[model samples]
Target: MSTLLATGFSAVAADSSSPQELIAKGEYLAIAADCGACHTSPKGGAAMSGGYGIQSPLGTIFASNITPSKVAGIGNYTEQDFARAVRQGINKQGQYLYPAMPYTSYSRITDSDIQALYAYFMHGVAAVDVKAPQTHLPFPFNIRSSMALWNTLFSNNKPFIAEESVSPQVNRGNYLVNALAHCDTCHTPRNALMGQDDSKALSGGSLGSWYAPNITPDKTSGIGSWSGEDLARYLKTGHLAGKAQAAGPMAEAVEHSLQHLSSADIEAMVAYLKQIPAVNTGGSQSRDSYGAASSTEQQMRGDQASAEPGWAVFSGSCANCHQANGEGTSYYPSLFHNSATGADNPTNLVSAILNGVHRNVNGQQVDMPVFGPDANFSMQLTDRQIADVSNYVLTTFGNPKVSVTAAQVQQIREGGPKPLLAQLTTPAVMIGIAAVVLLAAILLGVWVSNRRKKNVARK
Candidate 1:
């Protein structure tokens, strides 16, 4: 697959001579897209056997097993069945997959790539016969048919077309970002319908507990401060020393997907990302250009530990790995000049505190100890205590503007606010409701008519 550097992927994928080449290409494509991040269960199931429960506003939407199993997976799926499922969000059984699968972004996958993917799924990977737990979204959301209308309105069905104006490399990068990598699934803000708001594309999107920061090259609010190398390093390794570190979903992405891409593909992605239009999400300072090292660890040493809740927690729990100055070692990323802490939203910062950094990549475990209860390593911090420590870190080593509330910490802990899309004026929900109502009325009319006939017959 390293031969990808030798020729254009679009061309190479199409001209691959043997089944092995096609399978290899598909494997590489799957890595770039991070398919396993969603399909593979974090709770230790067979690879791609899919018991992974994705937390959405409505309920936990479980990912279906995509193994090539005859009974439990997609072994029976033809190429067309696989294509429809991947691009159009329709299953082999003609069911609508929830948008959590990112088929909208995958909709741009070229036919050749889709074929490669299909082949790989069928041949390259070992099949597991485990069935995924069925998703039981409450009420109207459970009506998967409504998604057809949603798709009609929101999803772009056309495949990606390489713009003649852009360089071939940039075009390749665009394909990866929009189609395969599905960056917009997290980075782009959603509309009221929970669809990607293209107007604010790559500006920043909410992941309930964590916020995906703006990546549109804005000097203040986004990654405009990062050089190409810095961005590439951050993407590949999930850290940039003094700049930023990945946690939550982004951490998983680096561990599973981005780190596995070839050097050529990485460059292509950066090249495309560099030229995208800058969008401002209303931050006055660069996320990576905030705060300084504090000597709180020193200040709190001996019996002089300040009673301030945040400082006390930081001095006691955080000062060990992060150091007294907040500079941190190579393994432990510094708290200051960090993107998560410096962002306008404290969600990411709070999230990291609540759910500590955990990623295993390149044969090493990069773990920040968890503070939450049940798994409360050394620190069994409460929600209020976590909030205080969050505020303390923000004020001392991160942004001074933003602060976390105990309620907010609790909300993040419990998957944030549930924005009921059905509660809105969405036509899709209304139509489903109307149809149900109409059916009920028809049934009532039939019952009344039958009762009248019964009386007549009795007479």
Candidate 2:
């Protein structure tokens, strides 16, 4: 069988002789799962105390505390409760958790791995007494019970079971990607129900202001050109010179999770990713295959004037890091042949420009200044300016086909395209609506019958 990576397993040796040993294994598993990325408050709070707010189409869903504190955290949670919450999206009190927890993918975790994770969280982590802010979505979404029906439709992936035809290594990689990493949560496009579209897994999805590009093996609009080494390295470090650089949530994933992964685990992920069906969501050519070094030395020299709106903004704000030719520095990255810059959506580019990039890889920090309105001091860019700069960058150093408008910039600034669940009429919603109607009709009929009886008695 054709494979993308040089195949081998580099094992992180595990010892399960004692409780401490299990806790150690669990700690490694937690890093692989990237629990910290969502649970850790970016604004400063106790670890796993969960004050972070994840913006979704439904609303800002704040992560809940998973610490060992009995007061507000999960200190009192039994192993069964933990398993239910992690795999079934149900809390100790039987309250349904939103899919934002990625329980769908987590459902694939093996029992042994779950035990290890449980041990680590229970005995390893420091308890934080504070609780995370509760997630209150809008309208029908706020109705957490609705998720029970949604779960019936979506969250059906069983625990990890290796396929007979595939190699154990590929299965191991599959376990990491689906069970622990939950790569599909970000990479796969969501259906009308806002659940991961199984048919189009890893064909790209939206992350509010930023868009997650395709990771399928397709030669066009995907990572088909990226070799096994390229992928493993990218996953480990979050940046591949002349290919792509991590920004936004991807950057955070790298900083918190992927970079910490063992090379063998990363290689396994690459191997599994290679075996998935290739999907071509868009483009005639690869995303990173677009563009070349741009020369705006004329603008720098101030010899001739061009009416391009983004030129001035680029020269002033971006040129310092990206350089006049968009070649970038060793510490930074090149604009041309980069994924975010070359993607057809232009969402990531505009978002990166607006929100900036911050990632720490191999102990080296990479920071890109945000250009959006709420940026530090007055360095913020207006919607119009952001649009202009985006257009300019796309035309010169990135995908020429993509462009953004001030209106679009404003929309992205507010939040990317809303999820389809609220707009579309799904079966679950119809049932809820029908139930309400039936209840209302029953109440009305009861009232009428009572009134008629009262009138007859009076007569």
lDDT measured at residue 342 in model 2 versus the true structure, 0 to 100:
83
lDDT of 1 by residue, 210-243 (tens): 8888999889988998999999998888989889
Q: What would the per-residue lDDT of candidate 2 be over residues 230-312, giving only the tens digit for each residue?
A: 99888988889989988888888888888877677888899999999999987888888778886764454565365576888
lDDT of 1: 0.86
TM-score of 2: 0.90
Q: Where does candidate 1 stray beyond 4 Å?
A: 1-12, 300-306, 420-459
- Candidate 2, residue 256: the lDDT equals 85
Clashing pairs in 1: none
Once all C-alphas are superposed, what RMSD does model 1 give against the true structure? Answer: 4.9
